[model samples]
Target: MSGYLFAILAAAACVAAFAGVYRARAIGAVATTGPLKAHSRPIYHGLNAAIWTAVPAFVVLLLWLAFQNSIIDQFVIGAVPGSETMESSARSLMTSEIRQVAAGNIFRQPTPEVQAAADHLRSLQAVSTYLLVAVTLAIAAIGAFLGMKVVSARYRARHSVETAVTIFMMFSSLVAIIITLGIIGSLVFEAMHFFAKVPVTEFIFGLRWEPQIAIRADQVAGQGAFGVLPVLYGTFLISGIAMLVAVPTGILSAIYLAEYAHPRFRAVVKPLLEILAGVPTVVYGFFAVLTVAPAIRAIGTAIGIPSSPNSALATGLVMGVMIIPFISSLSDDAFSAVPRAMRDGSLALGATKGETIRKVLLPAALPGIIGGVLLALSRAVGETMIVVMAAGLIAKITANPFDAVTTVTVQIVTLLIGDSEFDNPKTLAAFALGLVLFIVTLILNLIALRTVRKYREKY
Candidate 1:
């Protein structure tokens, strides 16, 4: 029933958008009379109207939908007898049961104390949903009507709509900025708490990393080392291997695809490469563990090297393969963005194709290539699944690529896996690791940005 109502609302919105567009066009067509001309094409006025109708109502609907549940819960709780005496946790559970019951599904009845509260919640939800639907429809109608009214003689609808759109776009850009700030703030706050409990020097410089600190006195080995050296070493080692494999393979593939491959070949091959990116990391994890790790171990044994079954090489190699599409796609864009004039001039100078490409094309596209590599590197660093599957859980401080090693991401996952306390050093340490990873990626991105900017200026 709710779905039917939502579908009706959506269909109405679409019709309103189309009607607004058609009305704007009709008004523009009528207004092209003697001596009073509009600034834009009729279609532009129509599109302006449609956008005004859709965007604002779409935004309002989203905001309302997001907050409606909390509002309904508050109202329902207030209406129930003695509900003011209920604990927040009890209230939360009662609300969950209320939602299930409202959906016409049987839920385990709430405790006797909250039974009346649950019943109240169901009624509130129905009322809230009806009210939300009406309000949303009303807003959409208002926006569409206002847009239609403005589509007349002497009305600069195109300019007005464009100004509104620019403001909306600015707000959209701030969403990403706000999210990033929120993440950084959370990481910093948790990391500060972790550092307060465990000394900063010990966490940073100590050579060991055993984060098992028991809160109870009876537990054996209460205090554990918080050394990040092992994790950092493993992180660097795996990332180094990933870069080693990814850079050459990715750049070469990109060069071939962008510069050498025929259009038909590109059409077939590009989609295949993108498909590689689409494969989930967990699926890659299984492949890395089952296929790559074993293959590496077998090959190593045949040769002189004693490769650990959970070698960093296996994780890195698979991660590199996983990130190949990221690098290739970005590099292709970068190469494509290089100006034709530069390539033509080099070719005109009697330079061979290879010589022109090396001297002119690659240099012109170097910044983009570097940016792609950095972005791919960031992906590699943050990747958890491939490492978790192929790399050992034991954080070993080692330089050997053939040995078992663990990364910061893997450690973070382990620290907070299950049955964890936020205050426990083990769980808290994950935030610290997360913070370090964040900072490292931030630095790489900044460098990439600067490099790209420098190259753009030169070009």
Candidate 2:
């Protein structure tokens, strides 16, 4: 039903645009008898009319759709017998069941009262949808009439259309800002709840990271430690190892592709390299678990170094291989963006090819390369599936790459598994960890932006 509303809106906008052009053309025909003409093109007038026809009614339709479900739930739940006396959770469950029945998802027999309530709910929804369609179409008609009234010989339809488009673009850009704020707000909100139960100092500075607490208020359980250092160290350790593996390799490959390889070879190699990014992270995890981890363990045993089967080394190496394309693709573009004249001038000044690439080309492309590296670093920090599959569940501060360690994301997943009661510190800790991760990623992004702005070379 809601889908049909979108179709109707689109059809109405198209019709309004055509009708507006027709009206403008008619006005032009009348004006040909005098020394008057349209101030704007017929297309501009049509676009303005389409905006007028769609915007107001679309806004109303969205508001109606957003609130209609909750409003219907309130009315329908009241019709359910004993709903008034049920606890909030029970009432919510009953409401869900009623909705399921109304949506034709019932798999078992419903009680007579529930069946009756479902019927009533369906009836109300049908009436509401019909009313919505009528009101929306009526508002659209009124808007079309208003728009057509302004379409005359000397109307500034172009200005009106431009203003409307500018506002739409501004809103489109604001959507990202709005989403960022919403994410930060949600993390902070839930994190504050966690902090209320556990001290911020303890969570941030304490060394242990056990996160066990009572699942229910009446149950007694051990008060778990909320130290984040172990996971933080593990995150950095794995990311550091990944950077070690990825940076030199990725940058070298980028340099080769951009400066050394023939054009045909570069084209073939770059696409094959980028194909790594398209390979799913789960496949990388599987590779780490089945292939990489075992090889590392075998090598460790042969060399007298004890290593866990799920070592950080294995995880980091596979993660590095996974992000190789992200770095190579970006770095290749960056190196290629350095003007050809710069390289030619270096050669003309009696510099070797290696020296030109090393000193001149690298410095010119440094900003973009740094930006790519940092973004890849950010990617490494946020990865979870590979960590979950290959890294240990145990969180411990360790310097050894061969040690089994966990990350913030892995810990968050561990703590939030199954049906978690968010009131407990055990579950709430995940939000705090998430807040920490979010801050780290945000910092990386800020640094990348600053670096790009500070030294970005323009050719």
Candidate 3:
């Protein structure tokens, strides 16, 4: 049976077990009414039984599935002929072929020994599946029996259920932390490999970025530069331009919507403005490439100014438009969160609406506005498609917005594409870029948090 089918059966068994246990508990509670008063509700008893039936069985199933492939492969390798004489790479290839043959996805003629091993693998997998089903169902049955036996009037079913729920929540939170740690660890490991090949200082401070290097000793091309500053410069330049366009326009729009606009108008306008955020970044990229870039170039040329077909100006402008809704929505919420009593008191003190808003509402909302801007800035920095389509991939340090330049994210994407040789610096450089990007973003988040906390405390 398929793993998914097994999962369904396991779930069904748990449900059936829970239903029987709950019915028995409910009947028992009503039958006796003396010093043995029911300590917890029938629902809690049912929930506790369900948790016991499912959790252990699911945990075992997950662990078995995680290690099943590796164990099966090891057994298959031991049985395959000439396996001990094969190199690591050759063994990996053979394993792939065996899996393909076993699954009936074979693309090439297999030797008799390989075919025999494949058949054996299929048999092993079938037996393993049967064992998994039996074991999981047995566990669920045992847990359900124990749970039902313990469901007396004095049993703390609510406490047990609540404890299980608390543990599950903690596990869920830990998963996120584990995933973040895994990402950082992977990046640092691969980045260390990259730095072993290229100097860290050169990668950080050098002004050029050309990661393509000759693979063969006889090749004529020299080792390409791995400088990161030019890419960082381009990222900052474009993001700065985007912030310039997004911040004022979004804040003003938010101010109008939150403070001045009629409720009916706000209802109509807010969703319309937020629609920009829902539009895919790729769509913004296409707009920039097909329309904005061309228009900018033509206008620049007509005015006797130089402009690239794919320039920072085009990408930044489109990115700014894309980020506007994020800023506007967040800022609107921030502005709306200010106390109405404060607004009323300011007006009662003879201050004009505009003056009250400027002196009172803006100050109160500044932290949230700053937070929204920071978030918008992060979105602009991490953006890939819009920059890739509208900004040409040339790593150069220049202040001119009309010039073509590339970002760190674009470079990371380029370096990782179709390059499987992790031993090479060219592929590993992607991790180096990723690490730097993560650090920069972390710093931004820290600053934003600190600023928000300070203002929040003062307010």
lDDT (tens digit, per residue) of candidate 2 on 1-459: 778887888899999999999999899888878899779888988988898998999999999999999999999998777889999999898888888998899899998988888999999999999999999999998988888889998999999999998998999989989998998999999999999999999999999998887557766556789999999999999998899999999999999999889999997999999999899999999999999999999998888887898999999999999888878888999998888899999999999999998889887898878877987898899899999899878899877678799998888888889998788899999999999998888787787778777776555
Better of 1 and 3 by TM-score: 3
Candidate maximizing TM-score: 3
lDDT (Cα) of model 1 = 0.81
TM-score of 1: 0.84
TM-score for each predicted model, relative to the true structure:
0.84, 0.89, 0.93
lDDT of 1 by residue, 266-338 (tens): 9999889879889999998999899999999998888878789899999999888888888888888888988
State each candidate's clash count.
0, 0, 0
Candidate 2: how many backbone clashes? 0
- Each prediction's RMSD to truth: 3.6, 3.1, 2.3
Q: State each model's CA lDDT, in order.
A: 0.81, 0.90, 0.88
- Where does candidate 2 stray beyond 4 Å? 25-34, 74-120, 214-221, 449-459
Give candidate 2's error at residue 345 in angstroms. Answer: 3.2
